[model samples]
Target: MAIKLLSQFLVILVVLVSLFVNNLVLASEQYKDPIVIGMSAAFTGASKNLGLELYHGSMAYINKINQSGGINGHPLVIKAYDDGYNPLPAIENTVNLVEEDEVTVLFDYVGDPTVTKILPLLKKYEAKNIMLFFPFTGAQSMRQVPYNQYVVNLRASYREETAGLVDHLLGIGHKRIAVFYQIDAYGRSGWDGVRKALEKYGLDIVAETTYRRGTEYNSSFNPQVQILQEADPDAIISIGNYQACAGFIRDARDANWDIPIANVSLVGSESLLKLLLETGRKTQRDYTQNLINSEILPSYEDLSLPAVKEYRNAINSYRGKSPITKENYTESGYNYVSFEGFLNAKLMVEILKRWTDFSDQDQLHEIVDHLNDFDLGIGVSLQFKHPEHQGLHQVYYTTVSNNKFVPLKDWRKWSK
Candidate 1:
């Protein structure tokens, strides 16, 4: 009897121990490791607002997705570094993100110079399956051969934007177009776009001026304004940032040379408008007269679109909970840059869902290359057809009205 009791006790003990070990293994499998995405953007210096807003918008959706059990039970994480909108730091940040952080993907990089500089690194790190997704610039380098396989663009190119602007201006009988551009790859891209569009009509840029990167709003743009004024062009397209563009607008208005100025989506329109409004209020002058800004994303105020409504709701919920530092934070309310960032995150998640195995990075290129007609609630289907990695080609134009950017319904407002 004693021997039989001991045997029964040992059997129970073994069964209990087996159950405990099995539970531990199941728990390990249940709680998977996080999927990390890396970013290198301008969190400091002149383009700080754009960087911070983009981060905030991406996090808004990412945080929600994680809360609801992230993509395939793997939480999404972002490891970001501030490049200060410079190329060298961007390269360093890219290396750190890939080598040390070991991020699963790279997303939402800012500025043309920084992105163009970092493109070569993707080929170098091809063994790591590194891909640059949704960089902020519309420069052609990312859309063309060599880098096209490694990069994907979520916004319209500068060529599309400039062509639309030139076509509209010409439709309204404004042909003599001048260009104010930053002397860099980005500026040259826009300059090239305008030149090509005008070439189709046998027209040419009547005047052109260049500004160095990081030119501040407090800096004098009187020289640039003088050059544009002397050209006597009917309209001017500016390929530069908010501070420099706003400063030029202020000076140009102060000089009373308001012959319709247009800017591409690269300029942070909200920030530019705010700066001009503040200056105008102080100086008792209207600096926003005859101003046009081309946008890659639809207007945020459009409530009818599912994407806009979702974006507003997401931003409202994510505000005050963003991880941005105090110095980098801004009251970015319904901004285009942030909206684009939000869409970037949304589409990434969608793609991951369709991918059979997210852990297999080697298969990413094949998946993305084959992805087609995926909708992000943006009223447009996104397709990543190979040899054409650019997802969106639609460009919208806006002008200042009642202290806000409204759609350009009538081109006659700026007719010469």
Candidate 2:
């Protein structure tokens, strides 16, 4: 009788232990699932420079976080599609990301035309309500009120960029400024910013010309170049991507027109410099000396700040190493886009860390929409109150010196 009772007790104990082990395995499997993020940007075309930089920069942060046991034990993963900086593919990519890929969030879209194209799709799938965070473009189309509240912007708007560049030019007494823009919403947005800034000073653009948006990065800007050169403005502001903008600069320079050329942030500064050095006739310094571009973030080289130091260290550590997207790692490593991408990812991790239910769209929005006066580690603050989701309101100006982008000290609007 005693042996039979002991056997029954042992059987009960075995069943309980089995249940505990099975639950542990199930829990582990649950935690193994990753957070999926979707992205669409120019990866193979004229705009690959910034597009790839943005990918690596943001991915560095995400990869680090995953290595450190990701937000709430779920790794962050990106599902990206290349739009080649065009509108049609961007629409398809956007829809597929939200529907087929079923990503929890969208991020780091590259161009104005792309983002503008995706807006209606987001509305069509409004029920999905997947939030788009920190697009690379500073175009105002998605940042305006009555704009898709689902969209979030990490960088300063083109309006702010053009305003700062205009302010700098005006302060330095360069009044006759010509606008060289791509014939698209992106270019027109910069044009609008310049116009608004000039209005304050009781002035307007001296001349304006445009190239097609999808022009080959290294293609001819001769028609636009000849027209702008004929205007003979004291200065010209190039508001296209690096490829076309560089083409415009090179062609204009070849025509013996050497006006001080300034560009908006979307031009991809370092890439622009590379083009000038590789394909242009003059010394790199000669072309870059008179060139200026607006920067949305402080220089990544300013390692005195803890955030900048962290960014540099992160990029250094992750350089040429990403399991997800190996192509992002370039021999020519960091730039403004990378720095901003890191910032975007840092903010993204912070946003995701605060919430756990990735399955619930409403849960994500709660954390995002209510981000009030949150102090970003860079000693600046970000907020996402309703009808306005643009995070950074400040802008900085930079110019190339010795093959690097250094601060244009007098042109920065934000205090250090």
Candidate 3:
């Protein structure tokens, strides 16, 4: 009887130890595979600036999270692919990220055309693409149906920026506003927004002009300048990127068209600033004295904010050099990249943690549908519901002084 009792106790002890080991293994498995977040952007070619900045920002945040032991103790892995600012390669990259790498989330890419190409694929897979931040510009199609379900815009929309511009000009008692915009989706969106906002003030656009994407005439404002001069508007609102805007500004100045110049967030880049300064120098010309730049994110030079300070430190630690350029780069400018990428990744992690199981796509959609009023402190807070996916409505106004953009007004949000 004694021998039998001892044998029974030993057997029970062995069973308890086995159970403990099994539990440990299960826990380890949970954290072993880092959650993969895929990114596709114009890492090369014409739009490389957009892609490079985004890549640096996303990587900086990934490093920060990993250093802190990751979200819920699980590491994050970013799988990045260069789409070269082209549609076909973008689709191919999306396929590889979803089918082969099995990424849990998708981050921002550069242009509307490229993103539009990949939207169907995302829908087909019902991809768990949690967030998309700062897609280069505020094209309305990006905020439209089916695509908006997965996108969270960080910058203020073209409509919001134009509204702010109109408000400022109206407050200063300037009536007749003129606009020069690209003839694509981005340009049309701004044009619509400006028209609607002006209508609110019982005003209207006196002159409106359109230009093609790669118009060489954009380099010298002689012809376009002649057109705007003929209109004789009090203020000019440009809705294109650096190359085009710079050309228009230079030519307008050379033509002696003196008026308050305002531009969209798309022109809010270091590269654009550098180009403008260079153009001014090369032509031995000075156009508008007070140039206004509306920004979607906080200025990189804002070192007073804790977030900005942290961002500077992160860039220094990770990249070993600052991301800001002497002509176009600001500490606050680089912040947009880090802030957006970091927040998107964090949101994805939070969603994953709340998920009881990752295998169920329906449950993932449910979680995303309820993600409203999420704040990332980049500039504007985000609120996403089932019917709306464009999370932000705020636009901040800034101006160029001594070749740096300075904030003009408090952040303004648009509704409806």
Indicate which candidate wins on lDDT: 1
Each model's total of backbone clashes: 0, 0, 7
**TM-score of every model?**
0.93, 0.89, 0.78
Summarize candidate 1's per-residue lDDT along 1-416 as a digit string, tens digits. Answer: 99999999999999999999999988876688988889999887877777888888888788889889888888888888989888999999999999999987799999998999999999899888788999999999988889988898888899999999999999999999999998888899999999999999999999999999878899999999998899899999999988899999999989988789999999999999999999989988888889999999888898989989988998888753334354434477788988988999998887777767656765777767655666677777666676759888889999999999998888886666
How would the candidate models be sorted by TM-score, starting from the highest? 1, 2, 3
Residue 380's lDDT within candidate 1 is 71
Task: Please rank every candidate by lDDT, starting with the best.
Answer: 1, 2, 3
The runs of at least 3 residues in candidate 1 whose Cα sits more than 4 Å from the true structure, single-residue gaps closed, are 1-30, 320-330, 358-362
TM-score of 3: 0.78
Q: Which candidate number has the best TM-score?
A: 1
lDDT of 3: 0.67
Off by over 4 Å in 2: 1-23, 26-30, 280-285, 319-328, 358-365, 410-416
For model 2, how does the per-residue alpha-carbon lDDT over 376-410 read when each residue is reduced to its tens digit? 66766775665567778778778777777898875
Q: Residue 178 in candidate 1 has what lDDT? A: 98
Candidate 3 C-alpha lDDT tens digits along 301-331? 7776655666666766665222222133233
